[model samples]
Target: MAELTLLQAINKALEQQMEKDKSVVVFGEDAGFEGGVFRVTAGLQKKFGEDRVFDTPIAEAAIVGNAIGMAINGLKPVAEIQFSGFMFPGYNQIVTHAARMRNRSRGKYGVPMVVRMPYGGGLRALEHHSESLETLFAHIPGLKLVIPSTPYDAKGLMIAAIQDPDPVIFMEPKRIYRAFKQEVPDQEYKVEIGKARVVKKGEGMTVVAWGAMMRETQKALKRLEKENIDVELIDLRTIAPLDYDTVLESVKKTGRLLVVSEQVKSLGIASELITRANEEAFLYLEAPPMRVTGHDITVPLPKGEHHHMVDEKRIAHTIKKLANYEV
Candidate 1:
């Protein structure tokens, strides 16, 4: 095992996949020469050569559209949309073409492509550089959604997404790219899609969250423990086809739930999880499922993000209310 940053792990995964599969190709804005705006793809173009890894024009629509064509033609294309917000330019192609192609052709055609984007906030980034839109893609049918919270998950899930036989939207918690280092196997390895990781276990309320929010959750858990709250924290690594069993089981044991995230509360992933708990684990609840999420408004400028974003205080407040107050 070797310690690697989230960015390093992703680079290793792409490097290994390119070596293992001749059909695997990577392309996107700055993906070739500059290694991407975040340097996630740095040195890949030089190592893999221009043919297998090359740069493309600054066009999300063109990038995604061509990836769909490549997948249909039997090539595994890993395309990058500079950021989560830029993905909308390619939304129609993803939903109507890449997503529906396999079902429309009745299995005659498919796009085994991975659309990667650096997502989430707390990076002090400008507009369009920070957005958590996993819920939007998860709501659409025919697309697989994977969000990696750690270096290990980032590397393993990227490999799996590349090899999946359908379109996949891979969201990375940009804020945690270098947050810490962890031992990630150097050899080939993969984590299955739609699976959640139980990061920490306890018997009190279950704090369910994913991506960048996982960091804040960890901090909040520490604070709660000081108050004698033994919270079980669940890192929901995947959003769509959620690991409902893992989360529901935790909810059952704790008899309370708090879903946290940095996305807007309106029609967000937190809302979906709350609905799921209601439908599947309503009776087991000691308190109504609560969500500590960003407000339903445009992401604020740097100075005001802290006010709108979820933090340790917000999480502790929810935990206290659920543990001490009436449902």
Candidate 2:
């Protein structure tokens, strides 16, 4: 095991998979010669040659459309969209074809592909470079949405997504791409998809988040620690196939649920989690489920993003309020 940053870990996962499977191909805008915008695919082309790892034109639609065809032909294609916001141009291909191929063919074909993109804010990126639209893709059936907050999960989940039999939307939080480092295993391992990881055990309340928001939530929880506010924290690694059982169990024990997400407030993941708690854990609730999320507006430009993004102050304040409730 060696300490590696999230970016390095991702590059390692792609390298290991390409080495193991001949069919695995990596391509996107600057993904080959440039090693991706963040260099997450660095040195891939040098080791695998241009055939296995190559660059693509600046066309999201064609990029995804070609990946769907490759998957159907029995080749695993891991295509990067450069940024999450750029995925809009290829929405038709993803929803109409890549997602529905298996069901549409009655199990005759499967789109075993991974669409990796950097998402969320805190990078001071331009408008289109900082959107967190995971909810849009999660609404479509047959697509698995995953967001990893740590280097360990980043490596394991990427490997798992590549091996899965369906299309996987691997949203890597740009905010935490190199935020910190952790001891990641060199050997191949899988952090099973559709599972929520409980990072801390507590009985006072439950705090749920994923991606970059998980880091901010951790900061808030650390502040609450000084006040003796023992709260459980869960990382919903897979957004689409949500691990509702882990969330419900925690709510049952703590009697309070607080979900945080970078995605704008509306019909998003936070709303879905609130609905789940009401449906399955209402009887055990000490107070109505709470949500600390971005406002229902387009993500503001970097200059004013601080006012819109969920930070440690907002999360901690909300947690304190919920803990003080007398219901």
**Regions of candidate 2 where Cα sits further than 4 Å from its true position:** none
Q: What does candidate 1's lDDT look like per residue over 69-186, in tens digits?
A: 9988889999999898889989989988887888889999989999999898887889877778888899888999998888999999999999999899998888998999999998
Once model 1 is optimally superposed onto the true structure by TM-score, how far is the C-alpha of residue 108 displaced, in angstroms? 1.2
Model 1 regions lying over 4 Å from their true place = none
* Candidate 1 TM-score versus the reference: 0.98
Instruction: Quantify all predictions' global Cα lDDT against the true fold.
Output: 0.89, 0.93
For every model in order, what is the number of clashing pairs?
Answer: 0, 0
Worst 10 residues of 2 by lDDT: 221-230
In the range 1-327, model 2's lDDT, one tens digit per residue, is: 999999899999999999999999999999999899899999999999998898999999999999999999989999999998889888889999988998989999999999999998878888888788999889999999999999999999999999999999999998899999999999999989999999999999999999999999999988877888889999999998989999999999999999998888889999999999999999999999999988988889989998889999999999999999887
TM-score of each: 0.98, 0.99
